[model samples]
Target: MKKSVTILFAFIISQFQAQPGNYYQQSAKYKMNIDVDAEKFTYQGEQTLEYTNNSPDELKVVYFHLYWNAFKPNSMMDQRVSGQGKNGDSRLQKDGVSRLASIPKNEEGSQNIHWIKQNGKELKFEIQETIMKVYLAESIKPNSTTTFTMDWDAVIPQQIRRSGRNNREGVDMTMTQWYPKIAEYDYDGWATFDYIGREFHAPFADFEVAIKINKDYVIGAGGILENPQGVKGYESKPLLSIDKNNKVTWRWTAKNILDFAWSADKDYKVKSFDVPEGPKVFLVYQQNNKTKAWEEAQPYVTKYFQIMNSHFGKYIYPTYTFIQGGDGGMEYGMCTMILGEAQNIKDLMGLMAHEGAHSWYQQMLATNESMRPWMDEGFTSYAEGYTMHQLFPEDLPNPFIKTLDSYRAFIKKGIEEPAVWLGDHHDNGSAYTYASYVKGELYLVQLGYIMGEQKLAEVLKQYYDQWSMRHPSDRDFLHIAQKVSGMDLKWFHNYWINTTKTIDYGIKDIKYDTKSTTIILINKGQVPMPIDFSVMTTDKKIITYQIPLNMTHTWKDKDMYGDFSTMPYWPWTQKEYTLTIPYTKSQLYVLGIDFSQRIADINMSDNFIEVK
Candidate 1:
């Protein structure tokens, strides 16, 4: 009996680590053919899915995401937006009211699955709003593969959300989540979060898609154009003649992408910029004055790819399409849909940098966003901040000061949910948005402050190389950081992510003599963080002092600023700590805590003391 129990325990542990090379995720291959009706604003699709079960559990049922169903009147997304009152999404509101509540039936979006078959046999299935569960006739054994064939018809919603038609920008269609997408199956089982107009998560797969549309419409999609010569926008490659019905079929293919998206319009002008050792950046938009900004942004976008590739991991795809479609910017597999109209080239470049950064954080890393949104949006925001700083260099010591301020604002509101809260189920939309985008982004910045910026950069590159194709959790990243920085970061994760604690450190007291000055630092807030203390002398030279948290048990090796003298670790139990510097009291002009503004200290006014 003892031996049997031990064997069972071993078996369970083995099943948990079943993925290939200890970083396993399920793989999918999709072959889809879509027929679009430009006049009616609808499409018919046929999909063949080949899914491999990399998990150890046997599959009795498979799920697919019917995301368009969320756009209907009184749907979950509509109701959520309506319930949020004025604090809800501005795009979903029209005339100071919820526009989704009044959408016309013809304009409403939906995917109606006609039939689903497993292998050669039809299967029993049920549609649960945004999720469709299909029961398999034969259970898929562990380490096996299954094929699912589906036929569906979908209506293009009248440009209300991510997947829509005739956006405000006048783009004819934005084809995102327009298909019966397969839901991700991981160690957490099926991820079938209802589409509440917040976040999306999916398994990475190879896509082969053929879109048939009116010959007049030009196409921009996520993947590579398999037959660019047959498409209109891809010039000077000659276009193939339209079919008998005045429609043309455009073929596209992408490998190891999370999802497939495409947009079509009658007036899109295509411009391509080639980046050395990176993807050919394609900017597609309607010809207008706004397009000039996009044109001016060509060199900046090229530089973005170059910096991101060298700093982060390399971008695998050879092409990336940036289309002027949708309410705002949204990232797809190898492309991004961004609103074209910008005030200037700089604003457009900022938007493009944020969305382009998603190509690495969201598209490549592919974290389970609904579960851990910060890993997706937060990491991307961090990259966006860095990219912007590099693109438009300012004299500010810390370029990520805005991100840190945003986090402080969220904390001051006193409505912040734990960063670990489910992406769609937060108490309010502000909590979800701020927690995911702002706090998540600040996590990296503050971490860089804690563990030296140079070390953080190394860890980020190593993380991207190891976990690009695999979804990584907060703990996974912390583990990587711990290994790289030789520091214990478990307390950092628990305090920052799992709780709503804030960090506040102030100068409690100061004493000085002829040869040395002593400053008392107090941790008044619930959260704890490493301190980067600095002192400015009357001679205009800055003397730096570093304090490592007792929890870390290790100090950051190097920082972006000049080297600093090490101080004792601040213990969490002890509220106040004293540090005595070699500078005399009369020689110091100002004593500041975190003068770089990297730490998210709630009460900033008390962080600095003026020498009298």
Candidate 2:
């Protein structure tokens, strides 16, 4: 008994030590000056970055991301879109041919580095497509800071992907990933993957940006505007002051954000609304019949922040913007660039809800998204579904019903990859989209099924309070889940993320005796989950049973859908379990598993056995 107690104490300490705060992440501070030529559709900029090494290991090398370079013909992004053919992004292809290959040279995007210096000494650097690696002349020691300066120029591509100029909607520019951003280095080492038109990951840092452009343009950006009073659409609405150069310098600053993005258009209409106890909301879009949705969405946008904060957590930033510029909708630091045109009010509200929810998971949570796109996209989708249900309660039988069916169909195709696959490495774009977005949402929905719904909400709040603004990994999230639910979630995380497994449970047989009834439940799918079985008698009374997986070591305190008696643990190794209840055959109306419909059981047809 003494030895057992000692081991248990040691294990508890180890688990506590393994929590998220054990590791360190580097930080960056950037100051930039940019000059744009609207007619030529290009820009030149200079940057000075102060990088702090928080890791124990000394850094001998640094890398940067030249994201716009991927818009050039024959680039990796263009090739990937081409290779995927009909299975790839529909925007990149036109009638079975890659549109990137046919784009004119003037429309193709490119970035050129003029010079780079480290601590006043020129450094040797190489550009491999979208990534630039700089060999350090003086390595940065542990806990030391290094300064690097660079001068570069870029031609903004015609609006094809996220960052570009001259979009179809006539927005002048959408500047995201427009600068030569330093690559993030964490415990996993340098994440310098080439930009392949997918997700991104970057260090949490501060940005001070100054842009000199014609005074006629109105801009919406990620950070707080330092010169809002000088701009026409701001609160003061002061007259524009033009210098001899006929240009105005717009200054912006953001703190502890992973990325800085902005959009500019001469005709943009700027509007603002405030969320009570939350951030101020900004809507920047063109004024037209097509953009009427933007004006209508202001109230709904404010309500979204309130709903998300009351349920998920508080919005960390003081302001959020919904800009009209990008191809479809893309989330940024403090703003999201969404297509201005909306089919209707519901369509506009849906997009705003999804992108707004992304601020919690993508902007503040700051997960290494390229490594785990599901954590960002999936969690964002889950929040969006809930927000939509709240905003439009008329369609609230189950918001996740469509997502569950989508995941089941993808699984049936036998082509779905594990959710653990890198965001850009997935073989099929459709598979990647479904796996990361739909299946990832289902992961949370089903967890809410296993634990009670109220407990799941508490777990999410706990996670946000602990991990926000820190670069959290999958283990970090799962650890919070285990701590909150008091259930072992290792098996759950492994089966759902690291492998392509399916969940299918069915009522295989039913038997009646003189005093009671017996039912056989079978696990037809490889993946195992806690079971919620319900039996309805002829008199309309319902009885529910909870069968938890043995791996969890404990079951939920109560069922969310109805009252249920806790049954014995269902050992995953055993494919079938015999469940006995105190009811005769004549008393039975229907016997079903997971009547709540929260579980993603693929074989729902066999889930219920009904008697007339």
Candidate 3:
């Protein structure tokens, strides 16, 4: 009994020590019943929110995000669209005019609260555009729970962004970020921001939602249907197309998820498939000649699951739905909504692969994507490229190079914001796309080159295991990488994310005596990274040399390009390096820096030279 008690005590200490400093995440149980008038594009809802303050500090007030309220004219999102001028989101513009600026009164969306009560006492509140601040009737004590109930009405805007009705793809609804979500509170306090058609940060909570809509419309959603017996053929077949005036109440429940989204269409066709040792996948899309590719790409999604599970991380959710949604793809909770119509199978599979990876990163490893969009968007893009490579080898051997090429083009454009910028704060749409998706993907690819690729693979899986169902900042991800690689990586993450500096390395010079050949490498860019220099011999043999960065304190335990001789450390301050090998120039055919092309070297023209 004494030995057992000692082991148990040590285990508890170890688990506590592994957590981030002062890390406490609060959550709530949201029980809601909504009635939708499909023709009017309006809804009424009643909410019962049971919130708990897990943080050490007591809570005097709380906030909620009224997302649809941004759809009105002169809103912050409308002004932001006009402010970006020609560089704003194209979807939000119509012939150089902001779409929201001229929306019709009835079509415009808004959320109006009737009243809010905390434990049966009415609370005073203030509405700040899309955000609502509620002064508590009674202060919520730490480690204690409080129940609040409210009634509200909402108008669904015409399809413009993720949350809308009647999208370009003819998806009747793309209900995303559609609720009056309670803002997340943690060590950072209340995370409340206006809806600007950007990223989101949500608290993980259980939901018991009952939505009333027309019975004829087939509803596909992110949550499991709790009353499937009542609504027959919901999982595998289309519901009976009956009277539009008749309403059917769909009771859906989800546990430990941040949000729930559902789309309804009379034309939606459902197909179900299972991945071995993985989640059950539901393909719900409107079928037509344009959407034939969705059917052809069904098997590819299974392959994608296999690759992601084998490499990055396991899909923690039991079910994943690929429902046809708005104009483009958006991920939420256990499912993702994507456009079903694709010109080709590869394009369909590519989008599915991208959104599917989000199930692992964005959906489960729920980061405050508004703050660290790179980890959410970039990591998903990285996984997408890798999965596409496996599915279609003829397209490219190393798909990551394609993203590097895109990054180089954007770097040449001379407009790059730091990765630390919030998702909505980027000056232009291009900057946001490149930073969050293109360059963000390069962050992981470069890290793989810095630490061994195997180490990076381990780091991703460990990160998923530790940070899923919670919010992880960029620093949290970096700590996991440092732990897995057993190296000092602060310099790498800081330089890469905090600055717009580029990486440019070149072969400067080569000299040879009868017994030895020497090579000189130069760093032409501001960012400093370890070098993997390789040489080709007269006998057609390729030999690689690894130069460890001084600040890294060590070299990769395993190199993806195979084994190599460890060269002396290269100091970041030094502009050039001279390396000598015990071979004559006559025995060498060529010399190059990073033949794998994994490094995002902005200037690659001078990276290689013939020495024979």
Candidate 4:
């Protein structure tokens, strides 16, 4: 008993020693009250935020994000639309007629000002240019607390992107991010940037929003509605209480969130269901002819929730709203704005699942999106693909759940591109989008293959648990992955994240002697990925091994032996590598390089070698 107790104590000590803490350690708590008049598409809100400055450096200024400014004409975001055509291209001509209309800058506007007593004096402040850097009268000491108040207004723009104004027959509004908000600050400082067509990262806080809208309209927002009394018999009072013309004010509050958004529509049909331990899934679709398709999509959405919660982690929020929006789906905290019209049920489900997964990556694990968009968008895309394959295995061509069919199609069509590229590259827009989404996901899939799923899942969970509300860079993610996988993946990271290299490993030659056999592996492509060689004998026995060729040990090594034979390792430099295996002449029948087809081996036909 004493020996066992000693061993247990030592194990506990080792675990404590190995625990990592530098990723994300701070938590934020805030309170907000929002009042909205839906007819005019104007909202006013007060946010009482309590921020804990956990970093070592003292903070002197706070930054808030004015995201709605992106919709204004001639803004940086508008320049993207103007420079690139409406679909993000400059050469295409406008088609004039569409459901979403582009609003001029003069029509769309937002104002945010704070009045506070700082250092025993009253100070008035106003914000412009999307991100406001407010200088505090007194410095917020490190590891201390501070309270601040903000008053802001948003004039909704015409429905162009995901957040806008529209009065369709079956939909009244699909408002999202239609508010003046604050950016996030962490060890890396404030995340303030002009709105771009990518992802979002916000600081976690509490929200209390009150919205006044037409009595005929049903509202869905980011948080739980606190006033059940107001909702009951809401349509009775036409002139005073709740009327078609007069606005009915509804109050909402959400705790432990980063942002607030809401939607309202008179023709909205609502369906509510609960997950086992997750948030209540609310499916909000148009009450018109689309109800049948929305109803058919419920089971798939529920399956996604189940699979995601079981695989990644539990849904942390209490309620999740899926409302009809424009073009594609966009994710917000606790609420996901999506377009529910799809000819194929599978496509709709896939879109919903992808956006829902973003709730964890972008909404929960709030990494600095402007700097490292891939950490959120890329990872979420990969997770979405995995969830789709898991739920619909028939769509996959292989038993390994790698979706060999889609991968082969992408390769054969010459659509493959490097995963690492600048966000504003001057390539074909379709190619850039493909590389950013598809190839980025492929990179994660390759990472999964490098480290088994169990280890990869553990790393992903740890990443969320540690950096959920913090800003993490690409290096941070790579470090955590290496620590969790117990593998030095610097080569993988360097070649995949920093360069545009392709992977091609094949069987160069095979030699058989009376006593032993030897196989030579060649690096045919520019990139060097860890090779998984499979050796099958005439007797039907198989042996598998991994070859580690990283940047550090790319040169030829004469002394090393065993699983990783003596060979020169070069990353995007050397063309070929030779490996000798010890097997009897009769024992070796065929040898294959990267036999599992896990790596994105660009060339595969030359991967097999036969021994006679």
Tens digits of lDDT, candidate 1, 219-302: 999888988888798878766868998999999999999999999999999989899999988888998986678878878888
For lDDT, candidate 2 versus 3, the one ahead is: 2
Full-model lDDT for every candidate: 0.87, 0.88, 0.85, 0.65
Question: How do the residues 457-571 of candidate 4 rate in per-residue lDDT, one tens digit apiece?
Answer: 7878877776665556677778888887777778777776566566777777776777776767777676666666768889987676666556433322211112323333434
The weakest ten consecutive residues by lDDT in model 1 span 16-25
Colliding residue pairs in candidate 1: 378-441
**Of 1 and 3, which scores higher on lDDT?**
1
- In model 2, pairs of residues that clash are none
Instruction: Please give, for residues 384-434, the per-residue lDDT of candidate 3 as tens digits.
Output: 988889898854425798888888888888888888898889988888898
TM-score of each: 0.96, 0.94, 0.94, 0.80
C-alpha lDDT of residue 32 in model 1: 95
Pairs that collide, model 3 = none
Residue-pair clashes per prediction, in order, are 1, 0, 0, 11
Question: How good is model 4 by TM-score?
Answer: 0.80
Candidate 1, superposed: residue stretches over 4 Å from native = 1-23, 94-96
